[model samples]
Target chain A: MGRIKLMGLAVSIGKVTERYPFAPVEVPDDYRGKPVIDPGICTGCGACASACPPQAIQVKEEGEFRVVHLFLGRCIFCGRCQDVCPEGAIRLTTEFELATPNHDDLHQFVRLRMVRCVRCGRPFDTYRHLVRSLREVPFIEGERLLLCPECRAKAPLDWLEGGGDGNEG
Target chain B: MGRSTLEGRFRVIDVSPDEVAEVVRELFEDGCYYATGMGVDERPLNGRFAVYHAINCPKRGVYVILRLTAPENRPSVPSITPVLRGAEWAEREAHDMVGVTFENHPNLERLILPEDWPDGVYPLRKDFPYNRKMAGTEGTAGVRGERHDEATMSVPLGPYHPLLHEPEYFELYVREDRIVGADYRGFHVHRGMEKLAESRMTLNQIPFLAERICGICGCTHSAAYCQAVEEAAGVEVPERALYIRSLMLEVERIHSHLLWFGVACHLLGFDSGFMHFWRAREYVMDIAELITGNRKTYGINLVGGVRRDLSGEKIQKTLKLLELAEGESREVIDNVVGMKELIARMEGVGVLRRKDAREIGVVGPVARASGIDTDVRRDHPYAAYGDLDFKVPVYRGCDVLSRFLVRVDETFESFSLVRQILENLPDGEIINEEYSLPYMEFGLGSTEAPRGEDVHMVLTGGENQVYRWHPRAPTYNNLPAVPLMLEGEDVADAPIIIASIDPCFSCTDHVSIVDAGSGRVLWRGPLLEGVERLRR
Candidate 1:
C-alpha cells in the first residue's frame, strides 16, 4: 500500500527538524543579516543612506553633527548598504537574531562632527568626510574645502582674476 | 495611430476610446487571452489619461497591447469586459486606483480600496502623495448583500478561516447541503505598493518591493519587474546572468510546488504526506540560501542583470541538492497518485470546463489542467527559457486531480531545467550597468509563476522613477474562477476546490459573505463541520 511506503520513507528520513533554540544552527558564510557600520572607518558620506531602498539608513544634519541613523526595525536585510559603502565601512554580518523588547535597541546613530564654512560660518560637510575627500583629490586647495558649497560657488571675482597665486593657506 | 515594438516581445498600438472594445474583442477572437490592464495618469505627460490592455497571442508568440487615451476633463473609456469576461476585475481595479471611468462595466464597484476609503480621491493620481493619510469616511461604500430568493441557507466561509492562509470573506448561498451561489470580497492587505513604487522608490529599489509581492514566488515578481525595466531601457543582460536567473527560478518553482503539495495534503487530512513533502522541500530551500544568501526572497535581480553569479562549486552543490529534491519529490508524488482515498477526494470535484477556463482567463497549471494548452515559458519565453527544453503537462479532466498531476509533472520538468541551466551557463559578466532610461516608454514583463502567468507593466519616467508600475499576480486572474468552481459542488469540497488553484490569497488581499433571500444569518463558523461530515 502507499501508506506503507510513506511510513518506510518517514522512518528512513528520521527526524529532519532541527533543535534550533536548544542547539546552535549553522548558517552559510554569505548569509545576509544584520548590517552594522564601522564608525571608525566611516566618513559620513551618506552613500549607503541614498542607496538603501527602505530608507532604513538616513543621514541628517543636527546642529554641529552629521548623524547617520541605521534603524534595524525597518531593515529588509537586502545588504544594499554594504554594496554602496565607499570605504567598506558597512558589513552585513550573520547576526539575524535581532528581536528586542526596547525600541531604542534597534537604533544605531553614528554622529560625526561637522566642519564650519570659513566665510559663511555655518556647519557644512562633516570634518572626516572633507578630510577623506581631500585625501582622494590632493590637488584641491584645503582653503577651498574649508568653505561651504554655497560659498565656494560664489567666491570673490578678484580671486578668479588672480587665479595663478590668489590666497594659499 | 502610431505602432511600436517593445523589446520584440510586445507590440503596442494606440486606438481611440470608442474602438477599444472592438479591438480587444477582435484580439480575443484571434486566439489571444487577456493578460492584464493598467490605467495611468498622463496629465503631466500630454494632458490626458491612458488605459492599456495587454493580451497574449499564443499563436503569434507576442503580447499585443491596446492603448487608448482620454481627455483630462473627460477620462472615460469603453469597457472591454462585455466582450472578454476576464477584463472585468482589471478594468474595475483601474477605475478604483486611477479615477478612470470605464463606461458600461457590469459591476465597477470598489475592487481594490477599502469600504471606508473616500470616493473621487484616487490614490494613484499624479497629485496624490504616497504617504498621505486620509480619514475613513462614514459608510461611503457599504457591503450590498443581495438577497437571492432560491437559496434558503447562507454559509459564510471567511474574512478569517482556519483553512485560508490570508484574510478573505466568501459568502456561499447553500440550499440543503448543495451550494447555489457564492460571492467573494478580499484585498485587505493592499499595502499601496504600486503607489509607493511610482512615487518614492527608484528603478533598482522597486525590484526589492516587487519581490515582496508574493511570499511563495517572490523571485518571479522581481524577475518580471527587472525584465520590464530592461526592456524599457534596452539593456543587454549578459549570457551568464540569464542562465543564473533561469536556474534560480527553477529552484524557486521546485520549492513552491513542494510547499503547495504539503499544504494540499494537510487540507486532505493526510498529515503524514504533508510532513514528508515538507521534509523533501528542505533541500530546495537550502540550495536557494546557498546561492542567493536569503531563502525566500532571493534578492538577486536588478534592472540590467542579476546581482549574484553561480560559481563552479556552488553549481556542483546545487546539482547534488537538485538530485535529492527530484528523487524525494518523485517518490512522494508517485505514492500520492496511487492512494485511492486521496485520489477519490480530488478526482471529479470542483470541475471547471475548458470553455469557462478560457473565458475566465486562467493561467499556469490550472489552465493546463483544463486543456487550454498555454505556457508563458514556451509561448513567450523570458529569462533564458528560450534555450531550455521542457514539457508543459496538460490534462482534460478539468478537475482537482488534473491540477495536482499538472504540478507533479512540472516539478520534474523544473529539475531538468535547473540541470540544463547549470551545465550550459556561459562565462561572462553577471551584471551590466551601461544603459540609459528613456522618458515615457512602455514595457511589459511576464513570467510563468508557480500559480500562473505573473505580469508586470512599467512606464518609464525621468530621474530613475517609474511613471506607473502595475504588477498583476497570477492569483488575480485565477481567483475569479473560484466562485464558478464552487457552484454546484458539495459544501465539504469547497476548501480543497479553492486550494486546488494553489490560491495565494496574500498575493491575490485578496474575499466571502453568504446572504439568503430572507437576509437571516444561519451558520457563522469554519468549514470544519463539512469536512467532518465528509469524513464520516
Candidate 2:
C-alpha cells in the first residue's frame, strides 16, 4: 500500500528536471554570468578593479596605455562591477560556461590610451576617462580639465604664487 | 573605556594580558558560551598585540567581548580553554595565525597552518606581505597519524575521503566495532581569506571575498559581514532592502536545507529519497536565480543594502516556485519519516543529550534537536526577521532523526517567510548611497545562517579597508559537538552521524578522520567499500 501511494505521488508530481547542453540552457533574466565589456564605452577608470572582491578585474598601466584585465576564474559573478561602473560599459550577460584549456583564455583584456597631464607631461589616467568626466561634469573645464589631479590642484596655486590672480586661470 | 559597536549587541571590555583568563572565567560562570576567540597584531596601531574572546550570553541576548593586550615583544595571554571547553580550537587558531601564545593551553600546536610552515612569521600581522609566493614543503612534515595501541583499533577516515569533498583527517579509536574516541585534524581549505580581505580588498570588495568563504551559504556570510560593517558605520538600510535580504535569506535557507536532506538520504543509502529531494530543491534554486541572478552564491548583498531589487514579476515568479518546493518537500519528508528502516537508523543513532549540547555549545538544528531552545533569528532579530513572525522548531529527540525533522520543518517555515517578505516589501532604494564609516569604529553582526548562527566582527580601518574582520561560520561552533555525538555509536554509523551535523568544510575548513592502529590503511581507496568491509 505504501509503495503504491509513493508511486502515485511520484507520477502526479511529473518530471521537474531540465535538459541542458542538449537543449539551450535556461537562465533567469538578470543572471550574473560572464561580464561583457564594451571597449567603446570603457574608460579604463579602474572602478571595476577596485570594486571586484577577488582582484579578478585588474587595471595595469603599461607606459602609455591602461590595460583592464578580467580573470574569469576569480570572478564570483556578484555583479558589483555592473553596479559600480560609472560609464555602464560592463554588464553581466547570460553566458556562464567559461571552461577553457589554456589559463590565459580565461582572461579578457581591454586597452585604453593614457591621458597625459597637460601641465606636467606625465601619463595620469585614460583619455576616455577624462573625456567622459568632461562630458558628465562641464563646470570644471577649459585648461584645468586637460591636466591631472596633481597638476590641476597645483595650477591654481602656481598662478597665485606667480603674482597673478587665481581667477585668471 | 572602549568604543561600543553594534548598538547594544556586543559589550566590549578591554583588559591587560594577566587579567584575560579572570574575565573569561567570570563570563563562563555567569552562563556564557564561547562564541569565538582571535589574536590581532596591533603593533603598528598600539605597539601591542591584542586578543579577543567573544562570549555569547544567549539568555541576556548580548555578546560580551573580552579583549586583552600583550606587549609586542611577548604576545602571551592566559588561555580560557581550561575553563571553557569550547575555546580550545579558537585559542589554538589565534596562536597559529597571529603568533600569540596562550599560556595554559593544553595543546598549543598549529591548528590552521601546515606544520611545516616557518615559525615566528604570522600571516595576519599588518606588516606581513599578503601575496608572497613561497616554495612548497616536501612531504607531510607533521601529518600526525595515530600510533598503535594494544586493546583498541584505530580507524582512519580522511584527509581525502569519498564521503567528503574537501580534505580532513579523522582518527577514530574503536574497540570491537564501537567507537571509543575520535580525533580530527582539518583546515585544508584555509586560503588565507581573512588576510586577503585585510590587504588586497577594499570595503566594497570584501563582501564578494566573504561570500566565497563557503559556496553553500556564501550569501549568508556576505550578509553577515555587510551587517557588521553597516552596524559599525551606523548605516540605516532601507526597509525595502531589509525585506529583500530576508527574502533572499529564506530562499537560500530552503535550498541549503534541501541540499543537506538529499545528502543525508544518500548517506542513509536511500538513493530514491536523495533523487526526489534534489529534484524538489531545483525549484528553490530557480527562485534564487530569478531573484538574485545566480543559483548558489547569490551576490545581491552590499554593505548598506542589496545590489538587486525585487520587482512585482520577480515576486510572483518566486511565489510560484516556493509553493512548488514546499509541496514537493512535504511529500518527500512525510514518506521518508514513515519508513521504518529510515526511522530506525536515524531515531536513536548519534544521540546528543540536551545538557551535553548546551555544554558543548552546539547551534542551529543540532542544538534545537537536543531541546536547547535557541534560534538567533528569533532571539536577536536582524534584517526583516523582527517584522515577520515564525516558529523556532524545537525537538527533544536528541538524535539524528530529530535533526532531520528540524531541517524539514525549517524548510516549510522558510517558504512562509519568503511569501511574507515579498508581500510586505516596502518601496524604497535597494542600496544606501550616503553613509560613511570613520576609522577605528568596531561592530558585531550576527545572522542565523541555515546551519546556525554566523557572526562577523569588523574593525573599520583607513583607506576604505577593514582593519580586522573575523567571520565565525556556524560550523565552527557546531563541529566541536560531533566528537561528543560520536562517543558510543556503532563504527558503521560513523559516516551518517558525522553527516548529521550537515558540516560545510569550506565554510569552516572543518573535517574528521578515523584510523585503526593496525597495519592496514582503512582509507586506502573506495571509502564505501572500506565501510562495507568494516560493517561485515
Candidate 3:
C-alpha cells in the first residue's frame, strides 16, 4: 500500500529507456529471420505449402515434376514452414529486412522450380513414378496426364490448347 | 458431494474397447459430442492395455469416462476413428506409446517415431526399461528411419536451431524452400517424468513431476494429475481448496494470455509490443512467486488440498495487482489491436476453416478462432469457472489475427475474472480432513492450459505408487493441423505463422512421412550431384 505516481516526483522510479530506431537493438542468436529457398534441391512437395498457414507458397505436383512458387507477402514468417520442410531447400535467411514500394513486390522469394513435366507448364513429373504399381485410375486420355518433353514436342498445339495447370480444368 | 445433474443425460455405461465404437455412436445419436479419450499403459501387473473413451452432452453439461483394457499378449481392438474423427490421433498415441493396435485404422503408421525406430519397443509400457541408451548410435535412440520415394532429405529443426526455443527435428521433403512434405520428431527435452513418477516417486512426490511438465501451465497439469490421483485415491478436496484452485486457474489464464501476447508481438516484428507485454507479464510472475515459492514453476497445487493458504492480505494484494494489470494492459493491448498494418497482415491470412478445425480437431484459441466452440473450461466446467461470470471470446476470422485477438481479449476477461474471485474469496480450511487418503480410484482431470485444454488421465495404487499417469497437453491434439495448415503457404511466413498456434514443441515429436512406404531417397548425392551432371 506504499506506492506513488512516478510522474509526481522529479526523480523517476526506473531508468529512462532509449529509442530502438536511434540504436541498433541487439538480436538474439536464435532470432528467426528471412526465408531462403534452395532452387536446385527443392522437391516442391508442398509441405511448406501445407505447413504455411498463410498459403504463401504454391507447390504444384502434377506427376513427377513439382513446382514451388513462393510469395512472401502472404508470409507470417512462422518458421514452421521451414521446420516442417522435409528438405533443407528452404532456410530462413538472416535478413528480416522486408519492405517494398509495391504490394506485389513484397512477394519476392529466393527461388522457384518446375520438376518432372514440361508441356502442361506445371511441375515436371512422371505419372508412373507418382503412382507406382497402384492400379487405381486407368486410361491415359480417359484420365489426365502430365506432358513430358517429348509429348509436348509431339503435340504442342494440343498440349497448349486445352492444357491447364494440374488441379485445374 | 456435488452430484452431476446431467446424470440422466450421460449414465455411465460400461463398454469394452471393442464396444467403444458402438457405445460412442449411440451417444452421438443422443447428441453427445466426443470430447476426448486416452490410451493407458498397464503392464507387468496384468500385462494389459487400457483405453478410456469420454463423451459430453452440452445440454446436460456433464462428462463420462469409459475404460477399455486389453491383455498384453495381443493388444488390438476395433477402430473408433471411423465413427469419430478425433479418435485418429488418440488411437495413434495408443499405438505409439501404449502399443494398442486399432484394427482397421487406415494409415496406421507411427505418428511420433521415425521410420528407422527399432521394432516392437513401445516406450510408455510400464516394463520398458527406464535407462537411457546411446543418442545417435543406437537406432532405438533417434527417431530417424528408412525412407521411400528415393528422395531422402534430413532437415533438423532444433536441439538449438534458429526460429525455435524448443529442441525438435522435422525431416523435410524439399526441391527448395517450399517443403513438399515433413516428419515431426521431438522429445529433445524428455525430462523422464513418467519413469520418475512410477518408479522413483511416491504419491506425495508426483505433483512436483506434474509441476515440472510445463513451467507456464504448471497449475493446470499438476492440478489435473493430482485430481486424477485424488479421485483414484478417493481423496476429496475441500470446497475452499476447490475455490482457490479455480482462482489459480484464472490467474494462470491471465499469465498465459499475457505471455502469448508477448510471443505474438515478437513474431510480428513488433519489438516494442513484445517488451511492453513481457514487462506487464513480470507483475503476474511476481505475484505467482510470492504465492508459490518458484518464479516460473508454481507448486501450489496438491492432491486433495492446496499446499498454502490465502489470507485477506494475500487476497487484497492479488486483487490490487489484477486491477493494476487490467488498467495498464488495456491501453497497451488497445494500441496493439490498433496496429492497422500488423492487423491487416494477419487478417484472413493462415485461415483454418471451421470444418478443418473440427475434422482435424485443432484445440484452444486456434479452434475458437475458427468458430469451433469447444473449451473444457466452458463445456464442462470443473473449477470456479462453473460458478464465475465470463464469456468465451470467439471469432470466425480463422486467421492469425483472430487467434491473436482471442488471446488478447481473453487476457482482459481473465484479469476481471481474477478480481471477481479475489473480492469474494471464500474462507475455510484449504484441506479436507476426510480426503487425506481413501483407497484406489481413477479420475480424469481437464484444465484449459495456456495453449489449450490439458487432459491428465491418472490411475492410482492407493498409497504405494501411481498405476499410470498420462498427461495429454493441448499441443498433442493440435500437432496434426500443422501439415494441414502449412499446405500452400509461403516459406517466409514460417516463423510467425507457426507461432500463431502458440505451439508447445516439447509435447510432440516426429511422425514419419514415408513416400508410399518406400524408404529410399530418389534424388541423393550432394547439391552439385545433379547440377554438376547437368552442366557437364
Cα lDDT of model 3 by residue, B308-349, tens digit? 677777677666776667766775677777777678668766
lDDT of 2 by residue, B180-236 (tens): 878777787687878878877889888877777776777788888998898888888
Fnat per candidate: 0.70, 0.60, 0.00
Interface RMSD (Cα, Å) for model 3 = 16.2
List the candidate 2 regions with Cα displacement exceeding 4 Å.
A1-4, A11-16, A101-105, A119-123, A136-141, A149-169, B1-6, B16-23, B134-148, B510-536
Q: Is the docking of candidate 1 incorrect, acceptable, medium or high quality?
A: medium
lDDT of 2 at B238: 79
Ranking by DockQ: 1, 2, 3
lDDT of 3 at B431: 64
- True lDDT of residue A53, candidate 3: 41
Residue A8's lDDT within candidate 3 is 28
Worst 10 residues of 2 chain B by lDDT: B511-520
The regions of model 3 sitting more than 4 angstroms off are A1-169, B1-13, B16-18, B25-37, B41-47, B55-60, B112-117, B129-164, B170-183, B436-440, B508-536
Q: CAPRI verdict on model 2?
A: medium
Query: For candidate 2, what is the lDDT?
Result: 0.79
lDDT for each residue of candidate 2 in A1-169, tens digit (9 for 90 to 100): 3335566876887875557677888887688889988899999988888887767899999999999999898887888888889889999999978887999878888999997887788998788877766666434344466777777667765443443332212
- Which lDDT tens digits does candidate 1 get at residues B70-180? 899999998989999999998988899898998999988998888888879998889999999999888464554464554345677776544544667777777677777
